[model samples]
Target: MALLNQDSDENPTPGPPRTTEAQYVASRSALWSGVSALFTDGRGRVVLEDVDYRPARLLPGGAIDAGEAPSLAVAREVREELGLTRTFSRALAVDWVPPGAPGYPQGFPGEVIYVFDGGILAEGDFARIRLPEREVTGVRCVEPALLPHHMGPGNARRALAALHARINGTGPAVLEDGRSISPTCLDDLEVLRTPRKPQLWPWHTGPAPDELQVRQSWGWLFSEDGRGLVLIGQDTGSACLPGGTVEPADHDDPARTLRREAWEEAQVRISDPLYLGYLHDDTGSQPCARVRYAAAITDWEPPSLDEATGQTYTRLLATPEQAAQLFDWDSQAAPQLAAVRAAREELGLPAPVRQQLTELPSHRPIQSPAVR
Candidate 1:
C-alpha cells in the first residue's frame, strides 16, 4: 500500500476540538454582577445614598470586583462608601438584567444583582454613618412607597421586591428586570403602588359623642398571625381598611355595617368586632365620625365582586407597623400604636413588627354577594 502520512487518517476523532484555556474563556459570553444592601430605619423607611455621579439615589452597595464573592463585594462597598464594617448573610433578592437597559451604555455586558438585608438601623447606627468625600453627596430615609420619586424605576422595583422578600422570610425572591418571576399575591395586586393619603385628623378612642354622626365603619381586621388586612380601592388606587359607608340596611349600627362591609368587600368573616376608636372626619363641609373596629378573621370565602365597587378589592396582610405606614399614620403614631395594642390584647397576641405585605389567598371566584 502507498505510504500514508502519520496524521492522515481518513476520519478524525469524532469529538469537540480542544482549545487552550484562554481560548475557551474567550469563546463564552461575559457578564458582571453587583451587590446591594437594603437598610431600613426600623420605622418602615429605606436608606438610600445620593451619589454625585448619578441623578437618582441607590441602596448602599456597588459592583463585585474581579474574583470577589458577592458577599465580600458588598462588605467592601459598604466599608468604602459608608465607612461601616458589616457582614451580610441573608440574600433578599437576585435579579438578572439584560444588556442595553437604560443608563447602560452599548457594548456593556448584562449584570446580575444580589440584594442583602442590612437589618433595621437604630438612631445610633445613623450617627455612625460617614459618607465619602466625593462619591456620595447625601443620604435619605424614605418610605418604601415613595422610592420612585428618589430612584430609577428599575432600582425602585428591585428595592421594593427586596423589602418584600426580607419580610416574607420564606426565601430570596428570584427576579428578572427587577420584577419577581413568580410573584406573591401582594405583588400581583401591586399593593402600596399609590401613596397613602396623609391624614392629620385627631383620633378619638371609645364611642363617638352622640352629636357626632357615625358616617363610616372600618376595622383593623387581623389574621391568625399578627397581620392586619388592607383593602386597595379598585377605582381610586387608594388603600384603606375593609369597611364602607354606613348603609340603611346596617340599621345605624356601625359595628353591623363593618361586619357586612368586610364580608362584602373581602369575603372574610370576622369574629365579634371590638370597638377600637374613630377618626374625626372634618375635612368635608359636614363633620362626622369614621368609626374603627378591631376584629379577627374567622373564615375566608371565595373571591367575589365587592357590590359597592362592583369589583373584587385587592386584599393584603401587613404588620401593624406596616399598616400604619401604609395608612400614613406614622405622624399620629400614638393612635396607631393604641389600636394595635388593643387589637393584640383582644386577640391574645404579642407585639407586632414591621413586615412585608402578603396576599390573602382566595379560592375560585363566586357570584357577587347581595348587598345588605
Candidate 2:
C-alpha cells in the first residue's frame, strides 16, 4: 500500500503539522508538585520549619525537582533543609491545591503536595537537626491543637488531617484544598484538634479518702477485644472516657454515675464496674476525687445526642495505652501504666498490643433518656 501523505500530492500546499497526544498534553496546564514530611516528637508535636522568606511555618520539605520522584524529592529536601538523612517509606496525605492558595501568587499554576511520614523523631534525632539558615531559619515542635497558630489555614488543616490519617493507620488520605475528599473516622471526629486538659492528678490505687468529695467518675469500658472506649467531645473535640460528673440522680455512687453517663453519652451499657482506684484532683476550687473504674460493654444502642453537650459524641475503641496518650498523661505515665494494668486484670482482658483507634459507627439515632 502507498503511504498516505497530503504533502506528496501534486496540487497540495503544505499545512501546519499535526500534534500528537503527548505534544498536546505537554501544552496543557500542569500542576507543580511539592513534597513534605510529617515528623513528631515523643509528645506527638509536629515538627515545622520556620522559613525565613515566609511568614507562616511549614512542614519540612521543598519543591520537587523536575522528573524527580516524590519519595526521592522528600529525602533530598530533608537532608538539605534539616541536615538529617532520612527516607520516607509511606505517604500520610496528598493534597490538591488550587491556584491563588497561600504562597502561590496570582496566575500561578496549582500544586499537588505529598506529605510523607517522617516517623517519630527520638531525642538523638532532634539533636541532629541542623537548619540551613538561607531557607529554614529555625525549627519548632507545635502541638497538633496549636498548629493553627503557626501555619496558614490550609496548611494547618492539611497537617492535622495527615496526623489523624497516620494515627488511624490507614493509607494516605486524599485531600482537596486541604480538606479531606472522604473524611475518615478521625477526621469526622476532629481528633487532636482539641486541647485535652492534662490529667496529671495523683492516681491512687488505694481507696479514695472519705473526706474528699467524689465529683467525677470515668471508666475504661472494654470490648471483647482489649480495647477501651474513648469519647470525643462534641463541643470541644476532646477525647475522654464515656463518663461525666456525678449527678444528683447517681445517689453518691461513682459507679452508678459512670454507668448512667456511658448510657447517656454513647448509648453503651456496661457491666461489672470494678473499682480501679481514684485520682485526687486538687486543681479545682476544692479538692475532689475522680473515681475510675473498669468494666465490659454488655450492650449498646444506636448513639444519640448527649443532652449535656447537645451533640452526639464520637465513640472510639482504643487500647488503654492509646487512651493515656490522648489524655496527655505524659508526666503521669507511671500511674497511667498502673491503671492500665489494673484495668486489664479487673476486666480479664489480655495484655494489649498497640493498635490504631477505630470508630463505632452507628447511623440510627435513638432518643437519649434523661440523666438518671
Q: List the residue pairs that clash in candidate 1.
A: none
Clashes of each: 0, 0
How displaced is residue 339 in candidate 2, in Å?
Answer: 4.8
**In model 2, where do residues sit more than 4 Å from their true spots?**
1-25, 122-124, 201-215, 247-253, 277-289, 308-311, 319-325, 331-372
Writing each residue's lDDT as its tens digit, candidate 2 over 269-335 gives 8887888788889998899998888888878877888888788887888777667656665455567
Winning candidate number (TM-score): 2
lDDT of 1 by residue, 1-372 (tens): 122234665764556654556666677878879999999875668899999998999999999988999999999998889888999999999998878788777887889999998987878888898989989887789877889999988899999888767756658999998999999755676656776566666788888999989999888888877788887766554678889899898899999998998889899988998888888878989899987888888888766888667877778887766666455554465665677677778787556555557668775345698999
Which whole-number lDDT from 0 to 100 does residue 165 have in model 2? 76
lDDT by candidate, in order shown: 0.81, 0.83
Q: Score every model by TM-score.
A: 0.74, 0.79
- The candidate that wins on lDDT is 2
lDDT of 2 at 167: 73
lDDT (0-100) at residue 22 of candidate 2? 64
